[model samples]
Target: MAGDRDWWFDEAAGPLIRPYAMTRGRTRPGAPNLNLVTQIRASRNRSDLSQLTPEHQEIVDLCERPLSVAEIAAYLNIPLVVAKILISDLLELGDVVAGAPFQTSDIVDTKFLQAVLDGIRRI
Candidate 1:
């Protein structure tokens, strides 16, 4: 008797049976094989970040402080992947600088070294 059609059931089923509800198949872990078809599909769906809106430009500007992609994503409340895309776009447009210049001095501050070690441990 409780199986009767109801508004809640209809609303729930709508999302469950939606075309976009299917899982995106996973890539073989660490495999070097890249499929051309998948590349083409991704290219078709990819957003051109270079042609960004004002909001996206704001996000890019926030990334100029040398934060990691994860940090940038957290600051902007966006996915890390999206942040990476924006960073990549900025890099292409010569709006971002790459890795810090290597210092000739072998001396690194103990606290900075410890922080790097801690980060490595988390990964």
Candidate 2:
């Protein structure tokens, strides 16, 4: 019951639950609304949270401040796929709002040519 490879067991003959099992081995997100950079914020309709497992609840609590799937995964120390699946559940249940994928828009440097020239002269 407490071994490294053990599964969750309630009864001696009860069905075993794996650690990584998500929505019964589901590989697809319910809404397909998430990406690495997609931002998620908690919604007002957390009524669905009552039916969630602890892991799901943790996700909701963490998203009180908007966060991305990758961040969630890192924070929870779980696989990205698992975080995505849980987030998808929250998305389908209307417990979370998914923003468009975040895009980095930093300006490029204008001094690259000067830097290159400096390096060439040093060489």
Candidate 3:
């Protein structure tokens, strides 16, 4: 009877591998500072990647150009949490580097605000 069962589900069936399976059920990144705006880029060292899973290797390739964590998630077609986990693994392996996000002081700078206002007023 098992052999006779339908092999495929309907078109709406979800991905074969759940996100948790990809990250081995890791919900938190080892590096806690990786926020949505944090920029990620490939490291120059170029360590051996044969030990990494395909997803991990793909992430390294994706980060050749600096990209925000949110952009990495969008590019990988994975959840934000999963992207973080993958990036954390890459970080531990020294395959990539994460750039700090803008500080609150930079966002609140009076000069930057005035520039924005001036540009808006010109339009």
Candidate 4:
């Protein structure tokens, strides 16, 4: 799957497809940096995103607030995987900024929260 980035499965073989996983050093406290998960997600998000897509625009807009990948994903009603892709793209484009750790808060929107709960019920 070196060249086929989206090839996540081998259907005919009935085996799990493996994508290349690169590793990098973790960020230290009070350091200015990006996490590997964030980088990967952002790259994937930007790969096919267009300016007109609400999801894409939402990501871009949220980055202005320096929201984490998890926060953005939850806010946009998109899968974490999808949010990661968008975040990675924004990071590469310098559209997203990293910041020091801050106070954690539970601030999920009702619409997104309901959608997530609905998905859980279906599953």
Backbone Cα, N, C clashes tallied per candidate: 0, 0, 0, 11
What TM-score number comes out for model 1? 0.39
For model 1, residues 21-108, the per-residue Cα lDDT tens digits are 1112222212222221111001213345567643345555565454554565565444444445545545555555445334535556
Using lDDT, give the best candidate's number. 3
Worst 10 residues of 3 by lDDT: 1-10
Please say which candidate is ahead in TM-score: 1 or 3.
3
Alpha-carbon error at 42 in model 1, in Å?
Answer: 28
lDDT of 4 by residue, 31-102 (tens): 224443332222223434464344455566555445666677566544455555555545556545555444
Q: Write the per-residue lDDT of candidate 2 for residues 1-123, one digit (tens) a residue.
A: 134223444546432554357456876667676789898899987765678986688788888998988998887656777788888888878888899754433326548756878999999
Off by over 4 Å in 1: 1-51, 100-123
RMSD of 1: 13.6
Off by more than 4 A, model 2: 1-19, 101-123
Candidate 1 lDDT at 104 equals: 37
RMSD of each: 13.6, 8.0, 8.0, 11.3
- In candidate 2, the residue pairs with backbone N, CA or C atoms under 3 Å apart (3 or more residues apart, or in different chains) clash, namely none
